[model samples]
Target: MQNTPENDHEQDAAPSKTRRKKDMHALQEIGEQLVELDPKKLNEFDLPEILLDAIHLARPMTKHGARRRQMQYIGRLMREVDMRPIQEKLDSWQQVSVHQTARLHQLERWRERLLTDEHALTEFAEKYPVADLQHLRLLIRNAHKEKAAEKPPKSFRLLFQALQATITEV
Candidate 1:
């Protein structure tokens, strides 16, 4: 007999995806609620919470628009977030960050020790690299003068395709 949808689903057609389906159903309900909510009801919710939740529930935006929008957000939030409490949190964060940085820096010095000691790399990568991990932070100071205004670099795939075209000509 030709199998029906019910029979196919029942015969362990791949491991069950019920959890994923449930999550999608819950998200659909949330999206329907957003469309259904009155502006006044949305306004009654905490402004920041509402903004964050609405953005989270919205469909993904185009990549270029999303990055520009995030930069705009950081600029706006930088102005509005309470400075002193934010500074205090940042200060604590800085201290923890510095401590972690120093610890990593010291461990990086010991990488050779890892090969000799056997447990060194395992313990380090598992916990934290014993090395300074200063990420490449950026700032476009005097952007108009420097002509270094910030934007994301082009996609690697595009770069590779361009390189391939240049290389293949006889």
Candidate 2:
């Protein structure tokens, strides 16, 4: 029951093994996420040649066992590279996509309000001083006419594009 040097060393070794396992599993999960990414987006990450080759090979793998083995190989390769930069690049890519989605939603909301409410134009112009109020008015009128006639939403699409441009410019 007495504290001993051997017992202290055993305690230290136990945590190191557990930590290594956890780190390995986390790396494997990251590798799996990398495999799921679009090839174009995957190319943006500066992965090692071996890991990149493994990912490319895994992409066409149909059999579950082959894919799993490839993923394990990718994880082992990942351990050789510094993961912090790769993690940061992935985080930034995700954030950019999220921001783009939010911006699209905002533009859609503005377009909807412009179609349904008369006061929305004034609000939009006030919020975006650089926007072309005259052009927006024309598009809104055309969009309303298209809606009444149940025609194709060409003007509505244009209005959405204008809104997007104006919002992004600001």
Candidate 3:
């Protein structure tokens, strides 16, 4: 057959081998992430029974080669499944976790500042007007004493929990 524009266009319509490989790898990575999910969370995804069985089989695998083969099989099965919802759910969970982590860091900074800087308590009261300044002050004092005595950080934990409550309320 002669090389024609129509034939060339038809050929170009298919994805390149490199692109196809990348897609398969991406799906495989998604499968790996799915396998790491909690069993309850995994059930939230309407995955195929075969794929679920494959994932279950992979969970107890101790050997490298067997798990690798199972993962590859899961990837192949993923090709037939609509991956959009699964990807979206994973993305949402990641975003929530990131936000929660950021919030925890912010609270930790506040707690450290409260412990080290006397002025930080006033600043915190100013920022979170609803905060019980007296209770916070007492907790800070106890936390200092606990640290000095090298005791368990009961007050320290209480301060964090208090901060968590105050910040969350805001």
Over 4 Å off, model 3: none
* Pairwise lDDT winner, candidates 2 and 3: 3
**TM-score of model 2 vs. true structure:** 0.84
Candidate 3 per-residue lDDT over residues 1-170, each given as its tens digit: 98999999988999999999999999989999999998999999999999999999898888999988888999999999998999999999999999999999999999999999989998999999999888999999999999999999999999999999999898
The lowest-lDDT stretch of 10 consecutive residues in candidate 3 is: 55-64
Every model's TM-score: 0.29, 0.84, 0.97
lDDT of 2 by residue, 50-75 (tens): 78899888888999998888888888
After TM-score superposition, the amount by which residue 40's alpha carbon in candidate 3 deviates from its true location, in angstroms, is 0.5
How far out, in Å, is residue 79 in model 3? 0.2
Q: Pick by TM-score: which candidate is best?
A: 3
Residues 27-84, candidate 1: write the lDDT tens digits. 4443334334556544533436644454444434458666445434433433433444
lDDT minimum window of 10 residues, candidate 2: 9-18
Clashes of each: 7, 0, 0
Candidate 1 has its poorest 10 consecutive residues by lDDT at 135-144
Q: Which stretches of candidate 2 lie over 4 Å from their true place?
A: 1-3, 13-21, 38-44
**By lDDT: ranked, best first:** 3, 2, 1
